[model samples]
Target: MANPQLHLLELNAKTGEVFLRLRKFPNIILTPPRWEDEPLLIPYLNDPRVCDWLSGPPYPYTLQDSKDFLARIKPPADEVIQHLKDADPAAAPIIVGECPVWSIREVRGSEEVFLGGISIIRCENGELMGPNGVDWENKKKREEENNALAVGDPSIIWTIGDWLAPSHHGRGIMTDVIRTLLNDWAVPRMGVRHVWATAFTGNEGSVKVFLKNGFKLVTTHENHVVVKGKMRGLHLLEWQYEG
Candidate 1:
């Protein structure tokens, strides 16, 4: 059977950001998620706070459900990295840094530490998806169509996702974590100049994070996302760095 490693290269786009060409993370000292993390991930997924905005995998997300999820989530060796340490069932692990793309923990340290993940589509010149340049036929089309681009033009924008353990909530952990990822990682590694985030309109907490982090409210679309069988509005936000 062909190893999944063979497909790992597929994770990169000639036009997007270039990841380190190996399995191990360079410049990051985080542990991988052990099988035990299933329990941690399960409760978070089932949390109404997190689940409400996400497209459902069904309510009452269970340990079995998390197991199935982890089982299916094969990390792309080159582009996707998962860090793990044996997690103590009693508490959340301290994470110092995380995968810049998916925001998975890459640096685990103190228990109260907060980690955030960020992903930026790297756009490069002379590639199949579309060559990099001023020509944004593909990107404009994606914006106009309300379509999902698996990874977007790296040069133009970075799609950021923020994840935090429940214990770390409401104390500016997520905001600080996001700032750290953008300042310390994404801009440095991926040359990301702009950050984009989508939050369900009703998710005031998330929207506040984006706003507090300097993302300007650009637009809103009604019925943009389906969650729990209902359509909800979504807010589009952007933070640009002119420097």
Candidate 2:
């Protein structure tokens, strides 16, 4: 609470970057991944306790993997800024033709700390989930064949994914992150009407994070996906934006 509005004021004073401030935690912000994040990204992600709940990250979470991830998630900062200007502040973070990803960051007076990542991915039609979980294998094939990112297509489904370092868990930081993203950015600016997410049924913390942000449990897929040679039950949650 001591941080006050200065955190945002300081962040916004800088040029050529976008920072999504968490409504409750004034020091916490979300910004596009930077080259400097590579070193920290590896360690935070390598924690099995953190990785087991996630779907995209592979085990070990090497430095090269972090580099490629940072390289690949290219958020159009300029476009987002322009949209903000056009809307006079209430603007969109459209990953229309690019990836909509942001690094979870904590800021002190002069230092910014990388915490984790939050991204809204456009799930392909009829491919949100398969029998064995996320159906990422087919999703990759579609990406490889099409060589194109979703371009605000009406039919495309949007889903969000996020991870927080183990050090920050149980404090409800992720709940605030999702709430800030939806209420401050995704809903008001991007016109995100619906977003879906999945979590292992047993992972009550993850499930609670989404539910706290107004996501409703829609279904549970028993033995939905195979992870580490074992089947895991995954539950689906959906958030419908209400203006």
Candidate 3:
């Protein structure tokens, strides 16, 4: 069984517009992926950095691989609802956790959708190694630091896995996506206290997004991520939402 932490839900394409309801942020429409988007998703999955974080695709990715993955993500049975009570509301609209997971999509012309990105909450008890490099002795210390930094309330760390289409890059699409996610979680529900994000030191693009969205740099590792075989520095960031 899929970890109850992760479950899928389907929404009527019309209601899915709830995904695009944010008028303040315009670059993104929060709709599902259309069947034609498989072509777009393929290149995103095949992108060098994207492939690094994901498990499959043997280097030069093939179109067939993309098609196969989509075939696996069949459409929803009926309208779906995901409930994520313990998740950080300031992160992504796609909630993924022990509570619930939501997948946002763009409605197609008549009856279809497209997949966007996955937003997840990863819990750590100070014993596990986090993306930034906390293990054993340092783990407890970091957790304590995080707790102290949070000033006593529970800390909900956030991370995003965005395979955003290239055409969408630099267009403020990501910013729109994040704002909508925050709005949904900040009102009429449990509000998140803080959010965490990490980016390879050189990824200026992602760094900007996090900053623009309110995430601040908390720490940085001189050489953290190993991509294509080389260790690169990483920046650890955080954000707090007030609603």
Candidate 4:
């Protein structure tokens, strides 16, 4: 549920481009990352202030790391790019899978500043159901249980993750980003009725962004995960479309 003051976004398929325009901040947009953004990611992602909060990107983020990440997302991105480029009048361009990412940028004339990244990943109940981030010894049972659930079948379940360049902190940029994603882009395009978000308990700024976007605090999982050899409590939030 986004702030009603902001309206829905249209990802025009016929334009052959994938970008999200913010209603409140017209200059800022979310687009797929390009190869040229390698150096940009290095500086932003390697900053300890940003990487420390993230579990995915490695510390001292390298060019190879960027390449690997970009390569992994290439398939789906290519699909969306192509669809958007040559889509029929009736086609609705979309990128659907376990993880769909976007690069947040502030467009300034011909230049686009890479602020950070965001992802809306489709997840399973088995993963979300667990409080402790632990590996099971019974590998066979784990596989069997996970196999039982189909991919994106119950499309209603999903979660979001995001990180911003340290410079962009305290600007309420991420808050509007989530608002635009839910109320504008993701809701209508993906039919995402339910979204869950989690942040380490002490990360109040991150938690507040989702809160501003209408997510309600569900519960805090104490010592739910280990980051950098330190156990951290996690706050889980839930948002359901009232529409």
lDDT by residue (1-243, candidate 3, tens digit) is 222211222234454422333345432344433346557666667676566544334455667766675564423311222333233455454332221223444434564344456453332334333565545567776565544433124364545545455555676666666666555542122235566666777778778887888888877777554655668676777777664
| TM-score of every prediction relative to native | 0.57, 0.77, 0.59, 0.79
TM-score, predicted candidate 4 vs. hidden true structure: 0.79
TM-score of the candidate numbered 2?
0.77
Worst 10 residues of 3 by lDDT: 1-10
Query: What lDDT does the true structure give each of the candidates?
Result: 0.50, 0.69, 0.50, 0.70
Q: What number of backbone clashes does candidate 3 have, counting pairs of residues 3 or more apart or in separate chains?
A: 10
Model 3 spans with C-alpha error above 4 angstroms: 1-20, 25-27, 31-40, 49-115, 123-133, 136-153, 186-190
| Native-to-model Cα distance after best TM-score fit, residue 1 in candidate 2, in Å | 26
Model 1, residue 167: distance off in Å is: 3.2
Error of 2 at 190 (Å): 1.6
Tens-digit lDDT string for candidate 4 (25-133): 8888887767767778888777877877777787778999999988777667666455444544344444333323388889898777889888876532244544454
- Once fitted onto the true fold, the runs of candidate 1 whose alpha carbons sit more than 4 angstroms away are 1-34, 56-58, 68-74, 77-156
Q: Which pairs clash (backbone N, Cα, C closer than 3 Å) in model 4? A: 16-84, 16-85
Instruction: Give the winner by lDDT.
Output: 4
Runs of candidate 2 with Cα error greater than 4 angstroms are 1-11, 14-16, 75-101, 128-155
Give stretches of model 4 more than 4 Å off. 1-16, 84-87, 91-101, 130-155
Model 4 whole-model lDDT (C-alpha atoms): 0.70
